[model samples]
Target: MPERALRNNSTPAELAVWHRISRFRPAFTRQLVEAPFIIDLACRQAKLAVEFDGSQHLDSVERDARRTAYLQSKGWTVIRLWNSDVLANPDGATLHVLEKAAECLGGTHPQPLPSREGRER
Candidate 1:
């Protein structure tokens, strides 16, 4: 499928986020084609889709809304994250995706342990 080609062309942010969540018990597939749409990353078993959007999306709010509505209508919970956010704070982005996935799967999301990297001394 054409969408499968996207896996190898993902942005750095997408790769970072995918690397973290791909280790989940259920697993997520990148560039999953769901007919009318191609999800960035999806855990079909949990009915969750995670999209990493760049600045272009900010100018396409309506388009994004329509896409999101369409996906939600099909029983998929969509989580859209800015690429900058994913790149700048991979742990935070991963946490958000995991939480959303847990919600759609009817389970509690696990929080990452506190870290000192960006914490106040």
Candidate 2:
């Protein structure tokens, strides 16, 4: 199995929530670092990962710490968000996740070519 498949073991709420946030047209894929065991979401191009932590995560300090360390070792910047936080403020969390991904991408992600919308300034 791939690395991502081993990572994302999020709750139903988190999974459903991230599914929406992932709608953003990022520079690359949204999920692929490691799967079921993964934190939450990720942008492969940026080498950044996002985790939506609910009650379970807090209950296991050692597991969380080890996971973070593993990601860092793989050169991935990890962003964590509490379940309640995301439920209360999804927009903020999504933006934060994007920013972290951008940070990993060196902050200069190449924008896709403009559509044929006509522009002759």
**lDDT of each structure?**
0.85, 0.65
Deviating ranges (above 4 Å) for candidate 1: 108-121
Candidate 2 per-residue C-alpha lDDT over 1-121 given as tens digits, one digit per residue, 9 for 90 to 100: 4545533555554665566655654643434535334545667777777776778777888988888888888877877788888878767766677666666767754344568788676
TM-score per model over all chains: 0.85, 0.70
What CA RMSD would you report for each candidate?
7.1, 4.3
| Overall local distance difference test of candidate 1 | 0.85
Q: 1-121 in candidate 1: lDDT tens per residue?
A: 4775787799999999888887775678899887888999898888898988999898999999999999999999998889988899999998888888778777745334556797677
Shift of residue 31 alpha carbon in model 2, Å: 6.1
Question: Per-residue error at 105 for model 2, in Å?
Answer: 1.1
